[model samples]
Target: MSVFAGHRLTCIRGQRVVFRDLSFEVNAGGLLLLVGANGSGKTSLLRLMAGLLAPAAGVICWDGDDVRRDAETFRGVMRYVGHLDAVKPALTVAEHLRFWAALQIAPGSPAQPEVTTALEAFGIAHLAELPGRFLSAGQRRRLALARLLLVPARLWLLDEPRTALDTAAVARLDAAIADHRRTGGVVVLSSHAGERPPEATVLNLDDFAAAATEAWGWREAW
Candidate 1:
């Protein structure tokens, strides 16, 4: 099944138009990479797919339903991790996972064990009690990613997911994404980093640069 289908999506920021008439389908078990130079609307497109930002035109369908019409339902089936960690500095690693799991409305009875297993899978179980503010940048990134394992979401919209990570952390992220794809989860991510798995389909934003200019009628900024 197609987890996400976007048709002629257009987004405008101020006088500059970003994407124009962009269309793509991400099926279950598929991994898609969005590659572009800085300020090329990669993040805007990701946000549109995540249902965080509405497109100025066209439709984004998630699991056969219009995301704009049924945002709550669409949100229930997807998870989004942006460039920032979104962790509460006062909370511990375990607390952060539990908090996000709750927000995702994951089944409460299994939340604790699920959080524990996710931390262990990322090799951060030993730091579970550490406060979010005290953890290193890499550790915080892992904790943000651990939210995915705690709750099973069919779609993942990630922005620069590999930032602030060591070699081992990058390996762990690759393995996690591989595992997700193996289990029929779909991922759409924007990254300037050259760390994507071999199977991912690359969508270069430069191909749409002219379209953006035509749609927005502005000079190229990037």
Candidate 2:
């Protein structure tokens, strides 16, 4: 089981600062929710945690190792799912999953059985042979999520994962997340929707409104 720790995180986008001195820790088997309004730096915070963006100040440590110092090593233990589905329109559902799975020397392969299981779990089994372009928005989202089952990483960084999912699909997503937590996997997600797994800790980005307001000067503009 691995753990992620961020201390005094500070991020800047151009002249505007997103956060300052923000810190949090998430261990394996835990879930953390990042909540905030639009343009409140929720995505920025997640990117920082995923090591896609560098913090202007402070450090992100994974299992006591500085992620910035060794990003590849840190990324090896983590999986990041952004708001956009990284699926190729030319590929079928199974092909998409297999492609991503082949890139990582991980525990599971996104072969037919596992792909079918994941698709069935998300109620997208019927779309297995369909190309990414042929699926609906919701179906594409499910296909993207199916990749998670194929690649078992200790930490998961999800940004609005429930987008475009139906009620049943949402329930399935919640169940999958719960199961991941039970298996000692860590998750940190940012979402405007109130849907969250049971017993998950909440971190409202509004708590840093003062910093955001001060950094962006929205008070004076509005």
Candidate 3:
């Protein structure tokens, strides 16, 4: 099985240090639930893991190579769903899915059936013809999220993915996570309290913060 590990990660924002000396690991078929209060660096950590933001210190490694060294390869294997719903307002839902799916596939790829399945799972199959501008907040979120299944990603880095999803849609998302894990995929998702699945690892950013603070206190005392 494959492994992804972040060793002694440090995140700094402007003049403030958000977090430091944080380490976490996720194995293939494992789920990592990121739990923390607001401004606790959960989003920053996810973005860092996605290779969107560079960590001030430490390394995120997939297998053995540092992800930052080959961000493109890391990105190819990852599906990062952030808070923003990045969609084209002029494109219909199906077109959006098709366009994204094609980019991830080779030339002359067959029609993607998962696009329809994802739309159905998100309960937006009926709105597949609707433009992005016509969709409600929840619908837009679902549409953005459905793109995950359209592409094959070994690592899923989700930032508050359940936001704007209905109860039924949440259930579907959970099921999808389970299926992904069963197929030996790794998932890291951030939530306030963190809704965990079976055999999932939990990372509390507060623990890291407290540990960093405690270490600073010890150094000062000594």
Best by TM-score: 1
Off by over 4 Å in 1: 106-113, 210-222
Candidate 3 lDDT (Cα, 0 to 1): 0.84
The window of 10 residues in a row where model 3 has the poorest summed lDDT is 210-219
| Model 2 lDDT-worst window of ten | 105-114
Model 3, runs deviating above 4 Å: 105-113, 210-222
* RMSD (Cα, Å) of model 1: 3.4
Superposed Cα deviation of residue 135, candidate 3 (Å): 0.9
State the displacement of the C-alpha of residue 52, model 1, in Å, after optimal TM-score superposition: 1.4
On a 0 to 100 scale, what is the lDDT of residue 35 in model 2? 91
For 25-125, candidate 1 gives per-residue lDDT tens digits of: 88888988999889888999888888778898999888787888977777878888898888788999998888777777633335444888899878899
Error of 2 at 4 (Å): 1.3
For model 2, what is the alpha-carbon lDDT of residue 110?
A: 29
What is the Cα-based lDDT of residue 2 in candidate 3? Answer: 47
Clashing pairs for model 1 are none
Please state the error at residue 168 of candidate 2 in Å. Answer: 0.8
**Candidate RMSDs in order:** 3.4, 3.8, 4.2
